[model samples]
Target: MTKLQPYEKRPYRPGVGMLLVNDGDLVFVGRRIDQRAEAWQMPQGGIDEGEDARTAAMRELEEEIGTAKAEIVAESRDWIYYDLPPDIADKVWKGQYRGQKQKWFLLRFRGQDSDIRLDTKHQEFDAWRWVPLDQVPALIVPFKQVLYRKVVQEFAPLLARA
Candidate 1:
């Protein structure tokens, strides 16, 4: 009989995040449907059992933003991690994970803005917009600001040539 670790000692949830960039070099962000404050984020979600991170990223992008019309430009050299605030750690992910370890993909958008649909069967966002890469860190929740900044920094060069 194995015992479970405390949530604080639990492993981070494995996840995938997408940095969808337009031809103009702006990144896509969406206002969270679950948050009341002005919190926005790039498309991201958990990796399903047996699914690879790249597949999960594309699936999450379509599920969250209703479009997968993007091509991968680059992948982060290493996984990035962030911890959930103590107050919310036990509330999210059924108290199983303390945070997320994410593989981020830089994808170039291949469709027009009109192609982005938010009214998916399971909607994650209420509104969406394109913003410069540097503005991403400020648009997300405070807890995720550092993660966003790291993502931006990692992908900035690829985004410039994209």
Candidate 2:
């Protein structure tokens, strides 16, 4: 029998993440510039105090990816958590957060390709592209792979219908 892994005792930052899809069911991902090395991830950001998860999801989608031209189609039933790899954990959130406890959302893009912009007032990604949902897990950092896989599994049906 496998032993259940215990949840880390560290605090997780409250954040919202987006799984934005186009008609072909491809998901939006971006190459993060703030990382010390190469990394690709979906749009995500911190949720402000008192903001509901859905509102934070929309706000994060636009703030990080440069567009709010999407509608929330589904939300994760529970908060999903990911811990930062030890090397950078103390540096990322000023030692206050170990990683993020995210509310993931599946958002359907309702605007043209031209409507997507990366050069927002506060840029998060250096480049962006649409990728098959299954490939997302492999593209992100190792620590977040499990979370990404769960996200793909959670939204696979909705992804197919788009």
Candidate 3:
């Protein structure tokens, strides 16, 4: 018997993101570099080789926000997915992998807010800010708003526990 890989038949694979929260408030929302005014999203990135979803989540959190995984206080158990907008999908990702299937995590900030730094090496985000949980949908890119809503709704219980 042999195991089959989904994307082995395709050109790309779906990635995940962690929507970290702290005391019911989401972490720093970012403005992407290419489309500064048009893009706003939770910290996220691609899953690496041999990396588990949780490991990718933790790595992305630190790489994007400069905060270590030890700083997170909570995370969601399930995942939320959203497809890419056809307009820029080919230009950016160039794939038939559908889109990102993110595992939204509700992290409680265990470290100081000052730990956030947008510029690492490559500069994934240009600017960021801590916003209220209710504001995430309106602040994210319009196409991604639907996923934001889903992620929030699915993780609503975690907020109540904060």
Q: Which digits, one per residue and each the tens of the lDDT, describe model 2 over residues 80-127?
A: 999887557755666566789999999999988888888988898999
Quality of model 1 by C-alpha lDDT: 0.91
Q: Which pairs clash (backbone N, Cα, C closer than 3 Å) in model 3?
A: 21-107, 73-108
The segments of candidate 2 whose C-alpha lies over 4 angstroms from its true place after superposition are: 1-9
Task: Give the number of the best model, judged by lDDT.
Answer: 1
Could you tell me the TM-score of candidate 2?
0.91
Candidate 1 per-residue lDDT over residues 2-56, each given as its tens digit: 4445867889999999999999999899999999798999999999999999999
Clashes of each: 0, 0, 2
TM-score of 3: 0.81
Comparison by lDDT, 2 against 3, better one = 2
Question: How well is each residue in 1-162 modelled by candidate 3, as lDDT tens digits?
Answer: 333324434333546666666553655688888784767788787888898877887788888888764444355556566666655554455445546666666566666777787778768788887787778889887778898898777666666666
Assess every candidate by TM-score.
0.95, 0.91, 0.81
Model 1, position 11: C-alpha lDDT score = 90
Worst 10 residues of 1 by lDDT: 1-10
